[model samples]
Target: LLSLIDQIPEDQRPPIKLPPYDRFGWFFGRNESETYDGTFQVGTGADHVQNTGVMRLWNGANRTDYYRDTCGTIRGTTGEVWPPFGRLRGTPPNVTVFAPDVCSSVTLQYLDEVERYGIAGLRWIGNDRMFDNGVHYEETACQCTAPEDECPVLDNGAMDVSECKFGAPATISFPHFYLANDSYHADITGMQPDPNEHRFEMELEPYTGVPLSVKAQLQVNLHMRNYGLTLLQGIPPVMLPVLWFRQTAALTDELADDIKIILILPDIGVYVAYGIGAIGIVGLVLAIYFSVTRWKLVGPEELPPKRAQPVMP
Candidate 1:
């Protein structure tokens, strides 16, 4: 169908018919079966604490063809898994994750310390700077260069993923346009952004680098504008949000308990050993001090016994 549309000359093409759907119905699910045959090669380093799982190959390619230059480079672990931080000196300021679906690597900023089931975790959340398309964040300028497709110049919080989607007029943003520009909310009527609910975040046990809880939220939008095509005509320039989704996960109670026993108990044992050794050293010092005092108290009386023994010799 795409090839057919391309074959038709723009000057002679007729008004294309669009699929039937309600105009206002943007939040709904469609029952469709899809198949994915992509391969991911990840290097499982010696263990969680050692050289751990980092992405080696994505869909049989080391680099993506979506964006140009370093923006297309594949780095960091897949969003789902990461190498263990293990006994680091301090909390990490950020964590890098390579999102294969988005065809980019995103850095999750450290928000705060959070605890679940008595286990402490470092909460990392996506900020306003990550999804920028060179409008607000200048570092992502390379991402604006779409290698094969014409990428739109979107405002902050929305990223053009048309090349990744095989030239579909698709873009991705935070759910409800949480960090998007005010103009986007003004253009749409039903958008109500909430930081508590719409934020994409992950909570990790910083010591083991285990994800205790995760809520990955993303909204898919269609850049609907007249591309000199009949079907696309009569539509206002708008980023029409088609659907939004949130993927969530959490650690079970049983697993949390196991982590405490495995990781927490050893520290308690070390503390107990130190306490015992401290007590023993204090007792030995007290004994030495008391013995010296007793000898000093008998000063002249103790000297008389030594003089009598010297006279007998």
Candidate 2:
């Protein structure tokens, strides 16, 4: 919807000047993630059970700049909020259930989704969440609503990057628009947001901590509020949710078997190398013994043979 109308004549543009960026408060992250709704050491031998505690942000916060969204910070403090693992506000549900090396039987419940992972050998996998395709709860990422709400925290059902994201007020909602609040859907025209059509979930293998199948489900939207006397005129006064997409990557059974083979081959190769080395070492010892005693250099009768010959002479 935005691509068709993005081109405005140079002279017909709005008087208000947009900043070089859309939002300029926070950074980004990597595979390094902090757990939510719990306090547990990652490598403490327990990764199944979830203990409730402070949420944390660990590693992979590189991008300090947003792509296109930018507004000069003057009123509210639009400062960078670094990711530190702590408190309810900091922990996101996505990274909370599982931590590296720490496998507790404790299952964590996030909103409508309860995380109950099943162990596979030495690792855990998404037994509970793998099939969790339905909408667990309402996703409210915006702060325009009730005062007591926590906005922008992922575990709160959605991830919000309004200021530091692409220009059109965007919020990433879970796949199954299951209980998408009315406020997010009421205004957009020509879009019928249905619960059944949009719901999505992920499948993960606990042992490898690798996503067996991943469908990065998200919804794109434009926050259409207060569009007075601008190019956005005639737009509805509501959050114009445009579309949602799920980017998927998965491991087929054959591919999964291939991966397992790939993972096992190296270990087998190492063991074979070790076994060959051991055999080679034993052979070397035998060869050295044979070479050293080839002519009976240290035979008990050697000294006597010389003495007996001298005596006989």
Q: lDDT of all the models against the reference?
A: 0.77, 0.38
TM-score of each: 0.74, 0.39
> Model 1: how far is 54 from its true place, Å?
1.5
Clashes of each: 0, 39
Cα lDDT for residue 238, candidate 2: 56
Could you tell me which 10 consecutive residues in candidate 2 have the lowest summed lDDT? Answer: 71-80
lDDT of 1 by residue, 37-107 (tens): 25678878854344466877888888898777767887777666777777667757688778756787777
Candidate 2 residues 1-313, lDDT tens each? 2332345665775443343443332222323545322232222214322322222221222112321111111111011111222223432344323221111111222223122222121112222232121133222112222132432232323333354343435554444333455444444445454534554434433324344543344565555555445567776655545566665665556756655765567689999999999999999999999977864786665545643545554
Q: What's model 2's overall lDDT?
A: 0.38
Off by over 4 Å in 2: 1-62, 67-166, 176-211, 229-237, 252-254, 277-313
Task: Please tell me which predicted candidate would have the highest TM-score against the true structure.
Answer: 1
